[model samples]
Target chain A: MMSTVLAMAAKDLRLLVRDRGGLFFTLAFPFLVAIFFGSIFSGGSGEPRQLQILVVDEDGSEGSSLFVESLDRSEALSVELSSRVEAVEQVRRGKSVAYVALLPGFGASLSHPFAGSPPRAELGVDPARGAEAGILQGLLTQFAAERLQDAFGDPSGLQENARSGLQAIELSGATGPQAEGLKRLLTEVDRFATTQDTADGQEPRSGGQGGGFKLEPIRIEKASIIVAKNGPPNAYAISFPQGILWGILGCTAAFGLSLVSERTSGTLVRLQSAPIGRGQILLGKALACFFACSVVSVALVIFGTLAFGLAPSSWGKVAVAIACAAMAFSGIMMFLATLGKTERAVSGVAWASLLIMAMLGGGMIPLFVMPGWMQTLSNISPVKWSILAMEGALWRGFGWDEMLLPCVVLLLVGSVGLLLGTKLFRWPNA
Target chain B: MIRLAGLTKKFGERFAVRSLDLDVPRGEVFGLLGPNGAGKTTTLSLMMGLLEPDAGVVDIAESGPPTDVGVRRKMGLAPQALALYQELTGRENLRFFGRIQGLSGTQLDERVDHGLEFVGLTPRANDLVAQYSGGMQRRLNLAAAILHEPQVLLLDEPTVGVDPQSRNHIFDNIEALKAQGRTIVYSTHYMEEAERLCDRVGILDQGELLALGGVNELIEAHGGLGVLTITTEAGEVRSIETENPVIALADWNRSELETVRSFEMERPGLERVFLNLTGRTLRDT
Candidate 1:
């Protein structure tokens, strides 16, 4: 029985080697899908992708240069300096997500902090990047707040700006009740700066801290919730799971088609008539599909590791995932074969069903990007579990207990599929 | 030896094989002659245990049932269709079947080689079955069937769609297998094939056995009578059925019957027997 089963599997492998269409779907197509999606996710690199933005410094002053430098150093934004015209053109053309421009008088206004037009700057964002635009705006605000902190840290500069502002106001206007109130505000501001400068490192006096008489600037500290080790090293680490899913889908369809072909061609009947149990035949088919899926998966992972820096955290866990995934998809192949009696019927039904599974399983779109409802629906797809299991070992940094759910789901689904498929399968001409 | 007792099979409302019984002695070549839908293939499948009988039993030399692995090991079937992997080379296909039959090492290699040579496919053995012509594919199918050297060989329309040359090659192979004392159940619609090859022939129609005997025995029993036709110089034609066609022809010449012009005689054959029993030509069905 073992010999017969081995012989059957060996025959299927030989056929697969010669089937060009099957080879493409099983091996080449999945690689292409991985590279395509990986490029989109990682910008084709190991680092997390940054939103590209252009900066136009019209003043080119020390303050404007400082602002540009701050934006350039941000982890979320990749900044490039350009002319205002060039920056606007790039944003309009969708080349950069957004651009920031600093007009003249921006450097002079930086001294007053809140007195004049508040460091005049223009933000031009690509309309399509509404979400990213909000992030960019918040980052610009944070950098501007740092400038305010620099102003508060130097009380002498604040006093000099207040004295200049009061002299200008007195020369431009005659005295009235409103003028008297402005004059009172300036006198108080001038007094506050003088006291802060004289006090030198002492805590600010209590009472006049409100109404533009500030004490200290607010600073925001940022941290990421996701642990560094738990995230993927590159997009390939994430995309390769989908790639393996594609390969498994291909194996399922190919083996399913082969089973129907054998039935229609009468070879299956011959095998049944041989001195082997019917169970041996089904086992032989399942083994062939499982081996094929495993080989494709391992090859894709190796290629991804060598070419794209995809690091699997645990080899033992990787083996578990691959074995379970292969088993699940092989059983799917059996069930698929039993769906129809003819090759054309089986091929059409199998591919359509697999494509749907692929769509739901995060093979077409990443699970993180899916809508909440779709993500919940994906739990039912074996593809989702297969990819989840693979990702857990590869980059998700899942411990053994964390990995148990997807692995167990895969095993249970496989066992059920194999049982149902074998039970429902029929030999040809019977 | 093979035996069937009240073998019956039904598909939906149609009876595929109805209450069939027969015994094929060891070393004999038996023919199951029928038309396209006459249940011959279904009966062969039941005998091979590929399908279950609705009622009755298939006994292979009284070694229990054909469903037994030990009994099945003694049988080989070349089905009506070409049951082969087109992508694999002929040699690869033979090797696969040989392995499935539990042949290995030197024995497997020798059997594969001999099977290829036996079917005259040795030269094209390395070529993919898809690349072969229909005749070559048919020959390779036969080679695969005989790779295990089973005691009983069941061939269902083995010469289907083959050229005359390939057909004769298959006929010779069956003869050789018979010479080696293998029990063979050969099925075909071609009566002449049955007449030429089978030691005993069974004629079947509509899932029922119409006649069963040697070719001569069937013809003598159910072939009716010799037919004699005479066309006279007066443009008159007469068909006379008689026990002796030669005697009838001599009588016609001796008579003053419009000065005999041309005469012909039709002797009883399997076709006549089939027509006599079923009242329909084998080709019609």
Candidate 2:
């Protein structure tokens, strides 16, 4: 019986090798996808990537130019100057995270503490990148606040601006209590500015609490949870997990389709006529799918290690992950085979179902990048467990204790699918 | 030897095989003759243990039901449909089937080669079956069935669609197997092939066996009479039905030898016997 099962599985493997399209989906396509995504995410260096933004300066004044320079000097931001239309276009096209456009009154508003209107900066940001928009807004506010600090540092400029503001208010001809209050406030500001300027050899109160007004800059220190020595060597370590899922999906679809083809082609009837039972037949199919999955996944990991600097902390854990993933997907293959009768029908349904599983399971996108609700939903996907198990060994530096959950989940999923698939299986004529 | 006692199978309200009782003794070539829906394939499936009988048993080699792996090992079936992997070569298909049948190593290789040679597929053994012609595929199906050298072989519609040459080739292969004293059950709707090869023929209709006996025995019992035609020199034609055409012809020659320019005789065959029993031609059914 064992010999018969092995023979059956061997035959399926031989057939898979001869099918060029199946072979490509099973092996080559997954590798190429890994390389493509890995290269994109690697970013060619270990340094943290800066949030890029475009700056549009309509004010065209020293104050506005200085603000732009300060933003350009920020380590967290990479600024590019462009026209308003071009800046918005770049932000819309996802070439830049957001755009900062300074209006015409920005320069004058920066010099005059008591001005007609405060400086205005319009932000055009990508809707999909809502997180980055908040960060960009915070950076813009910090740079604008620095201008206020500069105004306080030089009281001579403040006094001159205050006298011009008071003259303009008085010439405008208003006699209301509110107008009297504003004039009185400007007169006090002029007196204070003159006194501070007249004080001899006094250094600027850049950090002093003068006149009960002082701006304290908050310095933020950056850090990472993933230790450099234990973290992934490159993005390929992260991408190969998703790539392995694609390979497993290919195997699942191919094996499922092959089952329907066998029935339609009458080869299944011939198999039944042999001295093998139905259980053995299904087992043989699952074994074949498992072997194919394991081979494709192992080959992908090996290629990743050699070509893309994927460094798994533990080879033995990697093997365990591969085995569990293969087992889970083989069971899935069996379940998928029962979805339809004809090869065309089975192929359509299997791919649609598998694609959904892949999408939810982090086969298409990295799980860490998904939203909170999506990550919670991913727990239901075998792909999530597969990737988690793989990442644990490859770069997450998860010890055996931490690896228990994913392995157990994978095994449970495999067992359940296998049991259901076996119960639902039907012969060609049945 | 193969025996099916009171074998019954049904699909919904329809009887596929009703109370089928059959026995093909050792070394006999049994032909199961039926029309499109006459339960031939169903009966074969039961014999191969692919289906369970609703109310009976199928015994092969007098050991047990074919459902038992040991009993099934003694039987082989060539289904009407061509069963093969198109992606694999003819040699690979045979080898795989052989291995599943418990043949391995040098023995497996030899039997695969022999089976391919027997099917006239040796020259194209290494070519993928997808590239093979329909006739070649049919031949390979037979080869796969007989590759294991089973004690009892069941062939269902072995010559469904083929040219005359391929049909003859299959007949020769069956004859060769029969000569080896193997118990063979052949199922087909073609009466001529049955008349040519089957040791005993069973005529079936609507899931019931209408007649079962030697080819001549069934014909003699069910066939009505022989038709004799006499054509005179003046082109006058006369027809006579008789039990003994040779005796009738002798009397006609003595009485009116010169008046009869030429004569012809038509004997009752399986076709007539089937028509006589079913009230409809086999092809019509």
- Give the poorly placed runs of model 2, Cα more than 4 Å off: A42-216, A224-227, B228-240, B244-264
Q: Is the docking of candidate 1 incorrect, acceptable, medium or high quality?
A: medium
User: If chain B of candidate 2 is superposed on the true chain B, what is its TM-score?
Assistant: 0.92
DockQ, cand. 2: 0.58
Against the native complex, each candidate's DockQ, computed on alpha carbons, is 0.76, 0.58
Off by over 4 Å in 1: A44-227, B229-238, B255-264
Q: Rate the local accuracy (lDDT) of all candidates.
A: 0.83, 0.83
- Predicted candidate 2 versus true structure: per-residue lDDT over B130-208, tens digit per residue: 9998888999999999888998999999998887888999999999999999999999999999999999999988889
Candidate 2, residues A137-204, lDDT tens digits: the string is: 77877877787767656788768877987777777886665556666666776777888755655433
Give residue A101's error in model 2 in angstroms. 33
Give the per-residue lDDT digits (tens) of candidate 1, residues A68-155.
8877888877788898788866565334667777777666666565353467677777533444555766777788778866765776
Write down the worst ten-residue block by lDDT for model 1 chain A.
Answer: A216-225
Interface RMSDs of the predictions, in order, are 1.0, 0.9
Extract clashing residue pairs from model 2: none
For candidate 1, chain B by itself scores a TM value of 0.95
